[model samples]
Target chain A: MSKSQLNLTRIVLQDLWHNKWVMLLALLVVLNAIAVVYTSHEGRKYTSQWDQLLQERDRLDIEWRNLLLEEQSRSEHSRITRIATKELNMNRPLPKNEIVVRVP
Target chain B: MSKQAKRKQKPQLIQWRLYVVVGFVCLMFTSLIGRAAYIQIIEPEKLRHESDMRTLRTTSREVQRGLITDRNGEMLAVSVPVKAVYADPKVVHDKNGFADMRRWQALADVLHEPKEDILKRVQSNPRKRFTYLKRQVTPAVADYIKQLKLPGVYLKPESRRYYPTGEISAQLVGITNIDDKGIEGIENTYDDWLTGTPSKQKVRKSRDGHVVERLDMVQEGESPNDLVLSIDQRIQQLAYRELKKATEANQATSGSIVVLDVHTGEVLAMANTPSYNPNSRENLQGFRMRNRALTDSYEPGSTIKPFVVAAALEAGTIKVDDIIKTNPGRMRIGGKIVRDGRNYGDLSLSGILVHSSNVGMTKIALSMPVQELLGAYQTMGLGNYSGINLEGESAGLIHDRRRWSEFERATLSFGYGLMATPLQLARMYSILGNKGVLYPVSILKLKQEPEGTQVLSPEVAQSVMEMLVGVTEKGGTALKAHIEGYPVAGKTGTARKAVAGGYGEDYVALFAGVAPVHNPKLAIAVVVNEPKGDRYYGGDIAAPVFAAVMSGALQMLNVEPISKREKVRLAANSRSVE
Candidate 1:
């Protein structure tokens, strides 16, 4: 190689060595920006998952209330009595027919 | 000069200009850094809060109201989640005419409303933001409407109160309004305990109006406290059935029955006939809505005779076997004449109660101090609020000492001057059956034994109870009140209904009693208002109802029969049949 070309290469290498800290800082800044973007994206994904879970909980709560209401309506005493006396042909025993037995 | 010299001079000048430019650029960079530092460090929180305010929405969540259950955990009242459909009229109006018409038609079809009506409602106030399309729609209907995706249409979660037992428990469990607010009965009394507090939360929404994040709870919602009442569903149903039967059979105006726990002073059942169905408010009339057992008071006729007799005994002026002459069936007291249906010539104190002689009660009452009778009545919870916390409860009128005249005092002996609700009469009988210990009555379930005051000596109460038992025997006034295996002890009251000026032809038949006289567990009172036929007497009308209800209630409660006479009679009848 010619001396001028070699001299030019040496000057370029020296300039790079002198500004190595600035290059490292620029690389770090780019890495940090990528990390920020990735974490924010993950956060949004998890938040949506949490929202889905909340909605599921609300839906289940409503279902539970409905079931309780249904159970109450079905098990009402008056309804049972009506069914027993009407549909089942049941009748209360006469007082004279009821016998007392003591259990020991 | 040579060309090389010119180049060297230009390079030096260019270097000096470059230094000035670099200095200006650095000054600008420093200014920007300072401004950025000021924003990031000094006022970061304020700016962040301002940004959050714009994007972070606060929403209120409705908490479910608590359930009301009977003593055995049978649900009486419950709150179910429903949806309320609302519309933003302005949004509907902002659309073009065709689109708006299409939206209205779709919404109307979904809501089961007329399309023209919906359109008119929307256009009536174009500037109004919100209007209710429908309230308390089922979740399924709400889901269908939501799928339509009509602009400005929304479904908001709400709750509705439901009564499972319907009219049987209407007057006792009470009713709630459309907003899930308690308006009557136990619902009104325990509203605060049954109501739930709403919660506010912060949420982040996406562009499509989906909640993407739940930030934090601004305020925590409190789950409502469930109410455990003292009423037994089985007994309540029995009382309701019997009261309805008797009221219809007698063609009476209305009736009320109350069954109380003698030991706990807990009202097991309170049923009022002509009760309205709380679920539907369409045809509910004022008369049907009255909780007569707690709200209305009538002059309780012979029901008060026992109290006076007990007072006479307590004052030591009369003994259990002391004979008083009820000769000729009538006597004049002050200005009023008290009479019995027949001349029960002479009677022991127990005989007086058995015959329900008005003259006998008046003779015993006059022998005692007036204050003694009043004090006894007051101690038995007459003329006072029962502390049940029911709305519009009547403190039945018992005139004070200063207002007491000779005539008032005489009529008070026969249960004419003083008045009492059926519940109060039941409580009085409960006090007697509980060995004279007056327990404070409660409509709510008691977790522990209630405190009671000793109003009558146990001996005096025992004697009074014995006399009451005679009222249900073969020749007693309430022979129809007899149950097959249980010895019922009670009094029959046939009070002539007082009109505006004088007594009317109508009568209020009342029977107040306790069953299984050996170990009384229940105290029941039945009042039939204005019975039509020859069965207008308390013995004929109210006593039979008491017999039917008490028989079933005792069997349901598993109360063992302790009557020796009933056992002997049953054995004899069986032997004769064999």
Candidate 2:
């Protein structure tokens, strides 16, 4: 090997040995940057999950309201009366036919 | 040796150029520091706002209105979620050509509108950001439109009010407008309590228009508050059926029936015939929309006789059995003649009421001071608002005491000079059934019984009730009002309707009564206006309606028969009918 190139290699090795704390600090900075990237990505994932849940809740609420309205229309008095009198052949009994049996 | 000397001489000149280069680098560094300071300290707010505007968005959400239910928690009205179709004209014109006939035709067909009309509406306001294509479309239709994936078209969520009972309870429960605001009846009275507040939110969205983060709540959303009414759906249906049948059978112009719970003073049912269906309002007319029981008043005819008799009894001027002479069946006072159909000699007070003698009632009313009789009427809730919270309730007309001439006083005794609504008459009868305690009427269900004011002594009210009971006997005016299994107390009124200057040939047949007289569960009033049939008497028209409705109502409520004697009588009556 040439004498100057060999001398350059020795100088570099010596400098690295002397500045070990600075090298450790540089390694720590790079690790912290990686950690920041991972945490931000995880945060975005959770936020999207929350948004999806909220939308699902809204959809279910609307469905529940619609079902309640349906129940109301089905159980309306006029409709029930019509069905009872016409389709079921039911009629109100005479007062004389209704016997009162008292429960003891 | 000469070359080494030349190199050493040039090194000194190179040092001066290095100083110039160092000064130039220092100046550039200072300029960079100055710009950083300006951005960080001088105008930070503006820069931060600009960045936020690019990432953050504000959105608003609508909420549903509340439901209206009966006392038994049966839903009478409800709000259902719907969608409104809107479009941005500018966006449509920019994305698709302004003259895109195919797109317009597709939209028109989906909306059930003409293609030319759609094109005209969009082109008329080309600069507008938004225009409504259709409002209150069914969710299924909205979903179908969404699947079309048309540009510049969007669906916004909204709500609509629906009435389940249709025309049966339409006048009492009322209806809401297209914008979900109550326009009449109980709905109008409780509009604010039934509406819900909307909410606003701030969120951050990603590049693809998906919400990425919930930033903050700008306003909190409120769930709607439901309302519970005092009306019983079963009784309301019965009353509506009976009133409609009577009005149509008699060929009457209109009719009203009011049923009150005697104990609680709650109006169980108030129905008016010629009602419009709240669901479909395409051919609705103004005349058919009135809630006649509470909004219209007529001269109450013989319904006011009981109050005058009660007042006389209270003043110690007459007893239940005191005899009054009506031998001629007619009397003249101040050039106005009062008449009864037959000459009855020395009729007892109870017999007078049973016979509905106009001359007997006039003699009793004129014996008392005018102010005292007026006071009695006012105390009985006549000519006054019943404090019911329905919209457009009328306080029936009562003249000033100073204007009570002899003729007016005498006619008022027979129910000609003053007016009272059917609801007011029902309330008065309810007071008697409640043993003279006038409980405030309510349209909402009560959690506790309210305190009642003593309008008449209990003894006087009972005596009057006994006299009224005589009126439903075999020879009484309202024999048709009797239910076989219950004792009924009722008064019948057949008044000639007043026209422009004199009385018209038309009549208002009225019957106000309470049934199961021993316990008195219900007070009902029936009015048939201007019956065109040959038989227009209260006994023939209104009393039968009262009996039909009361019988059904009592059975529905499970009110027991008063006594075994009544049961036997009912069985015998049924056997006779069979």
Candidate 3:
């Protein structure tokens, strides 16, 4: 109601309209809110990806062991010996020539 | 004009709401388009992975094949753990995979192996999945392969068959293929049951690879059945070693020895020389694979003489002690010469048999009707399968009486035209050894046939059995076959092989005998085919091997010596008498 108070109110109104720096800051804050939500969702997606890879590794380990047993049940001695002696350079002892060396 | 003014002043609520509805539809359409684009193009793999995560891909865990065990738990054959190296040709053949190839070559060089071998293994495997490099690798070798960490390379477990005692009962065990399938032997006969069928099991696993639940219908394969043979390992070893020595010493074509229990009729041991190691099956000799005792046939010579003499006595044509004058070493019968070992004057039937007089035997056979003689041979079990367990068993050669030649009849009595396997011969004598009762032969089942009938009269059997004992006594033809502590009843036979319808210079020597005459235990048939020279008589060549085998067999059975003093006395008495 007084003349001094009326003059102060008018100055405040003028400053509010003229300040672009504060308005820009408010706009940036709203943009950052949207960015934060999107980035968090992406973080969760990658976390699940790492989890899926770990499962695959475990699956492969089990598969490898099972395949080994299957291969084992099917192998034969004659074939194994052929591979061992001819391919691997292992030799079987001759009955007539084998001699016992006394172990000290 | 007044109505138009009122409508313009108040905007219609329906039109305003229509604008809001269109805006909402546009927003929904935009969202749907964005979703389609994401699924189809922007992140196809990502979406597909998301869909696949709900699905579970599983495999079965393979169990190792079961083993075969023997009766006494002696490892006749077994499967041992081993490794096979394999490679994926597709991965190996990649264009930029040459870098890995160089690394592989360097590793192979460090392991002291040629790179060519590694390359060959890689090339051998089909590119689709896997190829074998080597099997039965040692721990150290497998470790080296693992350390190399070669890409597309893997190791697998495998099994190999091993026979502990080499070439022992090779025919009985049969053989197997590289895949552990029973290709031959007992393995083939019982393959499906031995290699159990596989089954599928469904299980839910946690994302961390821990199993959470197992679904129904998952079945593990059953193990193979165990087989216990009716053979004794110790007895088999005895026969094998002795036959090996005899065949080698005589430089004969091959040799066979079969020892059977007279009462039980169990073939305790069947051994053949010139056999191959089952572990190394390639380059096997046909002769080695043959079960000669059960498959091959030859003339019995004087060994069959006793059967005819026994037949005549049993038929009431002559008594055990009846006397007959034998021609001097040679006689012409049916346009063929029947020869004895030496000249003998008039002697009792039993004495004639003891000396192995072929001339006397021909006279006896000629006197009897051919029908009765043939019937007696049939009853004695010549020309019939002994029902052995091995493949390719022969029943020997027997010509019918309707087709008999007069000379053939005369020679057949003294074991010329009639041929029999060593097993058949031993089985025939086994009837005599078992008091004229015959039993069926089997390798799998240990049980015997129902109580057999009396083939010969009990008195006739006792007398003939008593007479056969003379062959192992001082004046008997097979005196060399006598065991020290136990009394032996046996016959020695040496017949020339008939080549081009006449006797060849080479002869087959055989000593078919039964030991512990008082109580017949084992009946053995020892056969040496085509011995080197003139000294190839049964008593000379085959009897020694018989003694060695019989000795080992007796010890193995834990049979007590009848008398220790008698053993020494008999040896002294035998050497002196000879």
Best by DockQ: 1
Model 2 Cα lDDT, one tens digit per residue, B184-243 = 888888999988888888988777766777778999977678898888988998899989
Q: Of the candidates numbered 1 and 3, which has the greater DockQ value? A: 1
**Clashing pairs counted in every model:** 0, 0, 4
Q: What residue pairs are clashing in model 2? A: none
**At residue B424, what lDDT does model 3 achieve?**
88
- Encode model 3's per-residue lDDT on B70-108: one tens digit a residue: 444444566554567777878866643446666777656
Off by over 4 Å in 1: A1-54, A101-103, B1-55, B97-100, B205-216, B401-408, B563-578
lDDT of 1 by residue, B1-578 (tens): 89988878744467778889999999999999988998898879988988787678987777888899999998888788899998888886675433646656776887799988777766788899999888988888888888877777788888888888899989888888888888888888888988989889998877666676778999998879999999999999989999999999999999999999999999999999998888886887888888999899999999989889888888899876677888999988677777788998978887788888888888888897888899889988998899787998998988885667666777889899778999999999987889999888899999999999899999888778767777877788888899877877799999999989989999999999987777789999999999997779999999998999898998898888665776565334322321
For every candidate, give the share of true A-B contacts it also has.
0.57, 0.55, 0.00
Model 3: how far is B276 from its true place, Å? 1.5
Q: Give the candidate order by descending lDDT.
A: 1, 2, 3
* Candidate 2 Cα errors over 4 Å, as ranges: A1-54, B1-51, B97-100, B128-130, B206-213, B220-223, B565-578
Best-to-worst order by DockQ is: 1, 2, 3
**What local lDDT does model 1 show for residue A38?**
93
Error of 2 at B490 (Å): 1.6
> TM-scores of the models, in the given order?
0.85, 0.84, 0.71
